[model samples]
Target chain A: MSRFARPHWVEKMSSGMAKPLIGEISAALDTLAATGVAGAIDLSGLPLTATDRAELEVALGSGEVEAKVTAAGTSEIRETGFAGVWWVRHFDAGGRVLAEILEIAFVPQLLGAQGDDIDAAARRLRTELARTPERETGRETVHAD
Target chain B: MQIDETTPNAARSAASGDDRTLGALLAARGVSRRAFLKYSSYLASLLALPASMAPAMAASLAKAQRQSVIWLSFQECTGCTESLTRSLSPTLDDLIFDFISLDYHHTLQAASGHAAEEARMQAMEAHKGKYIVAVDGSVPVKDGGIYSTIAGMSNLDILEETTKDAFAVVAIGSCAAFGGLPLADPNPTGAVPVTELVTDKPVINIPGCPPIPEAMAAVLAHVLTFGILPELDSLGRPKSFYGESVHDRCYRRPFYDRGEFAESFDDEGAKKGWCLYKLGCKGPATSNACATVKWNGGTSFPIEAGHPCLGCSEPGFWDMGGFYRALSVPTGDVARIAAVAAGAGVVAGAAAGALHRATKSAARGKHHTVTVEELEEK
Candidate 1:
């Protein structure tokens, strides 16, 4: 009979650092429970190892929502099934990881566009349209109904 | 020295004799059970109570008798009342106004002078040891509090005498809670907060230049439903509303993390929506629901509007070395502790990262080239 060795994945999952991370997340959830306020855990601020990050990902699996928003760069937001917790990752224009945060909110504010920005964009477009010649733009003119 | 009633509404219904429960009032006003339950759930969410507690809260609030409340205004700008009145129709403020029998308010009550005092005295005598006292503005203790008086009575004396038989006292604004702007440096009136004088009764401080209307309503709802005061922090503020620092939950926090700060109010970084740390946002030291609950029905907060936080909710904020000074420069223990904690977190994180990487090999797997399209697909 041959004895079996522990799997590499199992070895990678068990780490002393994982305990504190779990504790921090638990406390954050407690804050959410006591105050309707959301919390954020900045992964960039944390000393997270590849193995630790991987372990965390495995433990807190994704839920129903997964959103990828593009603005100055790209931001990917994923909600965990547990307690409205979210995993938000922001990337710069160069596609480099800018920030990795664990946010707790009903909706991730990072992925949602700001109302002011949307208003600015619309105003810019209207100004540009007014400046452009209607024939050159190759679009039908809009009229109020 | 009896004062005549100016309006017929001055002779309001006797608060003690009106035995109609809040639920019956709502029913009479054509409010449905479902709507009340929904409002209760919203309040629960705002109060940070569990979803399970909503039905219980609704039931309790429904059966609750209208409690008598005496609202006192002194050494104030009436901004707190203005903020409360700004709430739209059917808002929590309106609901709370409906829930409680506001027996006396110098600003809102039709009664004035001795008539107003008479109404207040009647309510106090009728519901002694049970009525709620909501106070705005600070009590000027200097020269026997002559700086601010109502009906020729000092604010200090009136507050002391009125709250003597009160169940609880709700300090409704930063002025009444922490002496506010009037208590700033070189305070001539010797303004003091309610917590400083009324130590015998439970005093809940809802501190803000003009506190969020919903915050006041939430505290009143908690008291009316549970017949007890909500859990408060060491600062005598409700823990739920004043639990987290504005910096922690700010929308621009990611910009702060990236070390992108707007040096000036009108700079390019400001236009690009960078962090306001360098511009002197007191968010790090201030703890309030402004970031989350927001103002004017969740329109925006000070930080969201591109202005740095004034830390108006915190005590002594008016004297916190100018509102435009960076938080990096410490004014007190709170700012110092926050900076020290940040430094410690970075050190701890780096050390942990180094330890975890120590066990790994220097050589890693071959790099994989991926397109943006592929990432998008994933």
Candidate 2:
């Protein structure tokens, strides 16, 4: 009875949230496969116990692709063990999580560079290329025009 | 008088006659799509909307016009305004300013005297039924509202006139939502909440001593994205934020369930962060986002700091009972005598026991069932 007491503590800590959330993720995965429409679940909005969160993390192991986006603040987008499932977390300046979500998509939208940014990058590259000296040293300089 | 505009982006756009959609405005300002995505996700989470709604919300917000807002302050302290300004950081929350054209505000606006009043009137005339009127204080109606007046116009008169053509009304604090402290005991001013006067428009109440800044921001964002108010509870509060009681989300809930309560402020249980329920915590009865969204940027709430919740968001919180009196204990002579005896250190245990027995006996006798209709009538 004394040895079983330890396991009871673990059970007491559990909010019984991880199992249902995993089921939701599976359903979302099925939806994504069938209709090519991505789904997302806001983790921050739910009242997840610490033990439940740990269990969720253990279930959704890390995958290959991992990307960090820096805009107003930093954001981490990582693929989970499931192919179409990704874990996205946005952090404030103080590194506190502002929002977290489980995204079911081929690729999370934040990872892609926007068209406006691409256009701005092109103009910036052109300006930098034009500013380069024609014959400063041994390397040949290419004109932007 | 000078008119200070705090929201430079919206003001600048309005000044330049740039009638482009919000998406175009963000692009013009070099705001990246990633930032918009992040903000949309945050807003969606705050509003308790499904995560899939982030993209739709972002798209809707981008195409939406800046919402016109007219802020009116009446019989209350400036704590609500102070809380909003101080708690909203320059991160995603500040984007609320860019989404709304705050045509008139007493505290945040630079205009004073006739200039401020004229601006409010002009905004009302220009936007008509398209503008939102946000009020932060209770309206005193005693003696024709002579207690509080602005520009020789009583609060009741102003609230009635401003809300006549408004799209919606937002009661920003407990004062404006539930008549708050001013309508507590004795009721000298005959104060009443915004819902009492404005029956025509949708009145959304964000009832807190000072509501969570994020909640306020999220409500505005919801309006901007959906062109309508969020789902409201019976008390006219946003169900997303006020759906759960503070005790339900409190960190010390386990201690409460385990029957490990701190009997005193400096006890061993107190040091170990046990429950404060015995110390008159109103968390069990109070519904607000304080325990979750928190104050000072998710830092801590009153219960987290070892203080009992005052149930500030509820109607008539001030007159409910003594702040240090437990909810189970009935208010009036017995509790008052117990408190006085305890203070005097004169047989405190006996007084407490008597009080407990009195409460038990009272409970046994009073089997009156209160119906929803009866509660509503009260």
RMSD of 2: 8.7
For candidate 1, lDDT tens digit of each residue in A17-112? 656877877887888888876666655434344577767877887798888865334567888867568886655343545346677666665455
lDDT, candidate 2, B1-378, per-residue tens: 222553333344545566887777777787776787788998888888888888778778878888888999998898898888888656766778888888888888877888678777777876778889999999999999999999999998888889999999999999999999898878899999999989999999998999888888899889999998999998899999898777766767666656677888999998988878778777766788888788876766888788988888877778655677654444455656655655433233334434543454354333233221222232
Span of 10 residues, lowest total lDDT, candidate 2 chain B: B367-376
Compared with the true structure, what per-residue lDDT tens digits does model 2 show for residues A20-89?
Answer: 9999999999999999989999898776756777888899998999999987688999998899999999
lDDT of 1 by residue, B1-378 (tens): 233453211123442245677877776775544445545655666677754465578778888887788899988999999887774233333667777878888889887877688888877877789999999999899998899888889999899989999999999999999999888878999999999999999999999988987789889999998999999988889988888777766767656656677888898999988878778787766778877667765556888888998888887777655677664332233323333434543222122222212321221122122221222232
Query: Considering only N, C-alpha and C atoms within 3 Å, which residue pairs clash in candidate 2?
Result: B4-B110
Chain B TM-scores per candidate, in order, are 0.85, 0.84
Off by over 4 Å in 2: A1-12, A114-145, B1-16, B329-378
TM-score, each model?
0.65, 0.82
The worst-scoring run of ten residues by lDDT in candidate 1 chain B lies at B363-372
